[model samples]
Target: MGQKKKEIIKSFLLTLAAIFIMFIILFPVYYIFTVSIKPAATLATTKIELIPRNVTLDAYREVLFGFKGSKISKNFTGTIEGQAKIEDGKLYLTDGKITGAIKYGPFTGLKFEIPVSGIIFDVSTTENFQGTLKGEIEGLFVLTRMNDDGSIGFGIVREVELTSGDVNGVSVSGPMEKYVVIRNTGKAEFTAVGKFLNSVFFGYLKNSLLLATLTVLLSMIFVVPAAYAFSRMQFFSRDHILYFYLMFTQVAGGLGIAGLIALYGMIVKLGLYDKLPVLSFIYAAGSVPFNTWLLKGYIDSISPDFDEAALVDGASYLQIIRYVLLPMALPGIATVAIFAFIGGWTEFILASLLLTEKNQPLSVWIYLLMGGIGRGIDWSYFAAAALLFALPVFVMFMLAQNYIRSGLTVGGLKE
Candidate 1:
């Protein structure tokens, strides 16, 4: 009775710990999705919220359209003391004391006065004019309307700092790049940013797919035979050579940054520098040691009796490997292939170093969006891209989840 009680208590504690760990792991994913839906105003609030007061799917729009922003008509909302009305292609804040076609935000409208050129003009800070917010401080406000006449502006009733790390870029003279997350302004908002992606996003995606597919194919071609040789066949110094390769996988000692740069330069000299297919060879080369290790362990688990049975039936070594060994080791192969594909998908540094603009993959494209020189980072677009980038791998993993579980134990050891 005592032992049974102790076992139950231990199981209960472990279950509780597992649930807690899962919550910790899943919270950041929840937060990312929330940020995608939350308005720009709520972004500035330091308050922690599991559920957003105002949710907008405009970020999804921006990702698809790559537009700077969606055109605002009669529908917009903001949490402020004043109401904004658009008339005759112009916006009028109930008390904002300004007249303009429209500029970005307080989608409804609120009056704001920023100190400018040694004068407190008390004029509305239109999106046309750059208003510097103290960096990293969360502010409460919405980018109202960027009017037809090409004047951009925003409204914030409460004094709040527009954080740099938040979605809104540093207040600059062109367009409103960031907005708040919570808006009480009762209007249909159009705040998506996908318009920018139309130009090169597809090309980048294509390059990435080509690289990943070829890498997987090449890796499998080389890995399977080598792993089978190591697992099933005995040759001179086989263990020694396998150990050397295992050591190489653990550490590539000589290929520091300088060596990598030199290698890239050589590829450039060989006229391979900007080609997407080059990544296949590079990535396949890198994957060999690990893939061989994984597949070897899996192949070892398949009983030698199968190989001998095939031989007794007059099956050649190649035929036995093809018809018998591969089918049995499908889980390990699938796992390695998925890993190789993801590795290609996320190869930013090497892609950037080796490929030029036209041939660069989506990884490099996202990196370039850091908004180059003084324009604050566009966190919304970045997050949106990250979410999109994650979808393929996530879906693939979910689809292959069974393989992951089945192949996780490669050594044929049963506990």
Candidate 2:
């Protein structure tokens, strides 16, 4: 009865610990998402609110669309109340006109009105301005009156310039230039903290995926053959050689491999410094020994009966290996693949050393974006990207979990 009670207590403690761990892991993810969706002003405040005070989608929209707003304006030229003649589809100012009219159309009517300044001139087909007018035309056109009764100035009116326009038509004078205002439309003011987090998060995720896939492929290619040869083939000093290879890998740490890279530069002269493929090759080499040992154990567990029987049926050594051995070792191969992929996905040192700026995998990019640069880490995007990057590995593990377990257990138990 006492032992039963102890087990029950242990189970309860384990459950509580698990819950705490889950909470610790999930809290940051929840917070980043909440903060990303919150308004920019609320993010700036010292007070911490569990729930976002103001929610806005402006940040996402801005990222998708460029910040520049389209411009629309109305131009007015000619006499206000005067008769103008159209000769060859061109308006000509005449002396009989009492007033000239110029009209600008198709104003965008954006919320903010912008000040206008620049030269505007009407050019003749001969590339000459009929008249040039400078200074401010409040509405659109500059008006001039002739001393003679019922007569207005007539010629090719060259240009009209507006020195100032209106902000929502409430008159203001300044140069015509672009300006952006981030307005707080919410009930409360808020600040956005999404920039860094968004960049780092996505960046790392991409890096992890690329690293994992390439590592798995390269590691499998090298490790499986090495394991097969070590386990199944007979050769002079094979056992000693395999043992030496395994022990050497165990002793040669990652930093020691830097020397090898330097040697490769001296010998091959390939100029492979800071290359992604070189990094992948290094990762593959590092993972090979352990993965080969794992696979060799699994391959040995498989009854040689399959290969022997295939040989009896006119199968050559290569044919038996291709057909019988590989098919039987599928689960083991998958286990090695998963292990290699995970190792590469999380590897930072080789990735950092070998990759350049544009080609740096997600891991290096995330580091650069987070803490390597001047402003420091962007936690929100980093979190979001991390979760995304982890999702696929998690799914892969979940899917292959049964196969992995079966493969690991294959040689251990004799049924």
Q: What is the C-alpha lDDT of each candidate?
A: 0.62, 0.55
Q: Model 2: which ten-residue window has the lowest total lDDT?
A: 182-191
lDDT of 1: 0.62
TM-score of 1: 0.64
The clash count of every prediction, one per candidate, is 43, 26
With candidate 1 superimposed using the best TM-score fit, by how many Å does residue 343's alpha carbon deviate from the native? 1.2
Over the stretch 1-415, how does candidate 1's per-residue lDDT look in tens digits?
9999999999999999999999999998877777667655233352456997687866656566442433323222222212333223222233322111222343322222222112121222343322222222223433444334333443332333222211134221111223323223322222222123222455567788888899999999999999999988989999899889979855773567876877788998999888778878988888888888887888888899999999999999889879998899999889889988988888888888888887888888888876552335545556676677778899999999999777767555632
Q: Candidate 1, which segments miss by more than 4 Å at Cα?
A: 1-9, 41-47, 67-199, 372-375, 410-415
Whole-model lDDT, model 2: 0.55
TM-score of candidate 2 to 2 decimals: 0.56
- Model 2 error, position 17 (Å): 5.2
Instruction: Highest lDDT: give the candidate number.
Output: 1
